[model samples]
Target chain A: MNKELVEKIKNDPNYQELVSKRSSFSIKLTIAMLAVYFAFILTIAFKPALLGTPLSADSVTTVGIPVGIAVIIFAFILTGIYTKRANTEFDDLTNKIKNAIKEH
Target chain B: MNRTFLFLVLGSIAVFASGAIEGEVQKQALNMSAIVMFLIFVSATLGITYWAAKRTKSAKDFYTAGGGITGFQNGMAIAGDYMSAASFLGISGLVYMKGYDGLIYSIGFLVGWPIILFMIAEPLRNLGKYTFADVASYRLRQTPIRTLAASGSIATVVLYLIAQMVGAGKLIELLFGLNYEVAVILVGVLMILYVTFGGMLATTWVQIIKAFLLLSGASFMAIAVMAHYDFSFGALFTHATELKGIAIMSPGGLVSDPISAISLAIALMFGTAGLPHILMRFFTVSDAKEARKSVFYATGFIGYFYILTFIIGFGAIVMVFKNPAYLDVVKNAVDGTSPILGGSNMAAIHLSHAVGGDFFLGFISAVAFATILAVVSGLTLAGASAISHDLYASVIKRGNVDSMKEMRVSKIATVILGIVAIIMGIMFEKQNIAFVVGLAFAIAASANFPILVLSMYWRKLTTRGAVVGGSLGLATAILLVILSPTVWVKILGYKTAIFPYEHPALFSVAVAFIAIWFFSITDKSENAKEEQEAFEAQYIRSQTGIGAEGASH
Candidate 1:
């Protein structure tokens, strides 16, 4: 890209907003994922029995099964949430930044 | 096209001749249905390759399928690449043996997708052209950065290829009653043809088809198992617990300590992001939006596939365990405990026959072999790209090479990689290759991921810092794995390992980041300053997709 166009986009508020909003959003989502995963990993590491406990007194199903499946589902859901926001909100700001540079 | 057909015929004939010679010694009945299904899959993929070869006219098409794949198709392809035979048979086999412990791997592998989607996918699509080295070397010195990235990529690819090839040989031997050497040669030749002739387009389609078949077959197995239990997991678990005790419902011996667990978790998560084949899929899509959508779909398919594998594992425990028909009676008599035919890794395969009968078993076997072929093809293509694109065209020719020559170089690299994979697969046939995959994940997490992420986000990442830090991470990962228990004690017959843990990502990744930070900040060179100044433009393009490759199209 040309230096002038890059400078214009860099100084544009839309670009700034897009960058900040998207980065923070991604960082937040990433932390959420890491927190969830690490929590499970720590549980597997430290207290295996906690996840080993059955769902009910008479149940053969353990707590870990649901928790593990939930983690997998949680990952998919987070990706969905991010894709939705990125394709709509983030793309809008990007297009606005592009338009501003073109107008200049 | 005629040469391609001739090559395929010769390869199949060689495989059959070897299989026949080995069959006499083994005295194993050939699985005709499995052989037929495998032949069908091979012919179909070869057909796709012929079509793809006609369309693969440029270096662009050779690498990223001319950036024409849709989000959903790319998503399936990514899932195909991720859900290899290792994950399918390996993870399910773990579950069948250890129960809940297998889910740990499934979860570790699945969790990487969200992080990739949030952090790497869009920037990778915007900044890269063919390989991830494109993105990593965006503002850094091309030669050093490309060399480092390509080394890491090739290392990761070859290690992963060896594991997949070994697993394929073993699985095919048990599933199709084929000879191990024949299976390896078949995989090697087919993979070389797909990649050299068809390139990314053929490889992607093969993965998509294999992913579909694998998902459908596993889904059928899981559903059949559930149906036997009235669609209640509680019933399946109840029966499994009754047969194998309640320990099957809980964690066994997969992860014994905290450090190992965390280290392994780190490797599995970040390793997915650093994988050249998986990362290369981002460029297969048209734009950032498609990239984002692809990850969404990929995560869903992969996550769901893991769930199915988990179910299949539990189902095997319920249905295949202690079943006299599936058990090797002579081995069980000697061992005093019933062992399933072909080891625990064949748990899901045996479960297919138990639940869905011989025809389904044949289908699953074909799908399993197809999965191996697709994964190895992708790995060879990625390795070839690392050699041809990063090392040859960029580093050697200094970006002056023509596209046609680059394509030829890649095809040559593909054939060499295929041969190496076959040789290594045969050599490691009797060795414990489970750690090889773990080592691949560690190298990727520690080496490729840190440099790629730092180059994009860290403003001070110079060529010196990247090369030094990346090479250190790569070396550390390899060295530590050698010293770790899996290699040192298990493979090398050492008394005790110097390193207590089996995984080195937690330490090696930290070392890489710290070294990169230290070296980058300490370097006050004019080149370093220029790189830092150039980051703004790179970041702008990364975020906004301005001047991104294939963006105009």
Candidate 2:
């Protein structure tokens, strides 16, 4: 470990913010995905008849089709959502903290 | 990148056109177009290996490709590494056989990508140098932790390698009319060549190429399938229901009960995060940002690929179900129902023929073989690294060995693994490849995932806790799997299973977590205290990416 960088990162407020914000944000997103995934899995476990219901009165497609697709598409959307925040918010704080340490 | 895509597109079109002409005649058992297409792919990959071998000089280059790969490239390689024969042939076949149940598997496989992205990817890139053990052993005693982690990795990799090798053998024999032993040897030798000579670079490139071919081939099949019904998914679904039944639109008999479904879900979700070969891909990138970006790209590509497979599966239900041309007439004699030429695994292949003809079938068969080769190479490299880097260099020599010597040992380990895989693959050819892969995932999720997550996030985790808990998890998973229905009754010919469930993750993971909590908190040893204090350094490093090895550049 580099003693200087470790100490600097430990003492910086921006570093603290980066850690907290990123952790909370990731945790939130994780919970969201898990909620959807577990809901689907539990439905499959307990009442699969719910998934078996038709999407429309006349349609042959089941509700599970779009629901499953939504789960997958939601994964892509969440990744994009995280990357959008990370590349902007998190990367900015990291660069600021690194620069602050360098100047000192 | 453009050049690679262009070559793939042109090559596929040529195969498609040639296959259309070949499809006009009665279907031959041995399709020459598939053989020629496979030869082209093999020669192309071998050329890449020759080029990569020249640049692979040191241990760093051998293990992590000199950390030169960008995010997009590593993402492609990761997708390539992940989309195994099971995902391609197995998933589509499931969909072809049992309609809505297949999507459940696709969802289970895809959901893990997002979890990995949210939690594991960036920290993993920051903490580890070469292997997942590097991260797990950061605050613990290196030798013991490395030994446990390496054993877990080797077990997972060998099981996965055998499954992939057997799949390749069966697929090749079906497609090219070759012997299973010959096919297994071909796959095994090719994997050893990629790992021993070109190392990670060759394996990554091979995976990327195979990913491209599979995506394109599957995409074409989906498009062709949609075109058959005027490109309407609604029409596709309607036709599928009309052909099979109304119930085909929903979940079927795959998930027996709540316990097994949830247990299988747990294994699939966490297992991806713990797989050694997949985690090792992060180190090939330059930084945590690249690792993060790689996951984003991987999730997008993998999600899209799963959707295409859904379309291909439903397409097969409509197209390949009753078609006599693709059916085995003799099997129909026993059942009075039309079955596909091979088992359900041939659904995607037969669908390709129904849509594009023999050339397209040839192209897909080649891509399937390529998928097996790419996955096996990644598994073999991870296993070799466990033996050489973790066991030989770190444990035996205490990190005092020459880098060149370590690389040499890795190459030798690769050869030995290749031979072992060939033998095990042949022995397990008659066994259920899917069941074997499930055991690998269960061990990984139960043993590796619990320890890895606790080490990264928990401050109280001691060296003893990790070792004891990890071993318990590993042992419990293996024991429970043996006693479970899949192995006990099916494999060992028993009347009833000691453990009634099919999956062991629900029990094994809980045991690991409980043991970790108990051992880590109760132990008051000086070593435990030191490990607890060192967690601050490890946490800061994992979070801020400071003092991370190879991060200076």
Candidate with maximal TM-score: 1
Once fitted onto the true fold, the runs of candidate 2 whose alpha carbons sit more than 4 angstroms away are: A2-7, B1-28, B432-434, B551-553
The deviation in Å at residue B188 for candidate 1 is: 0.7
Q: Across residues A8-97, which tens digit of lDDT does each residue of candidate 2 receive?
A: 778889989998999999999999999999889878766778888997899988899999999999988999899888878888887887
| DockQ agreement of candidate 1 with the native complex | 0.89
Could you say which candidate leads in lDDT? 1
Q: Candidate 1 versus the native: TM-score?
A: 0.95
**Leading candidate by DockQ:** 1
> Which portions of model 1 show Cα errors greater than 4 Å?
B1-27, B551-553
Residue-level lDDT of model 2, residues B1-553, one tens digit each, is 0111111111111111111111111223777998999999999999999999998999999999988888999999999999887678777877886678778778888889888988898888889999999999988999999999999999999888877776677678778888778989999999898899999999999999999999999999999999888987788988888888887787766564667767777888888888999999999998888888899999888988988988999999888999888878887999977877777767898999999898898899899889889989999999999999999999999999999999999999999999999999788766644356667887889788988889999999998889899999999989987887666876688999898777788899889899988999998999999999888778887876766667222
For all candidates in order, state the fraction of native interface contacts they contain.
Answer: 0.92, 0.76
Model 2, position B525: C-alpha lDDT score: 100
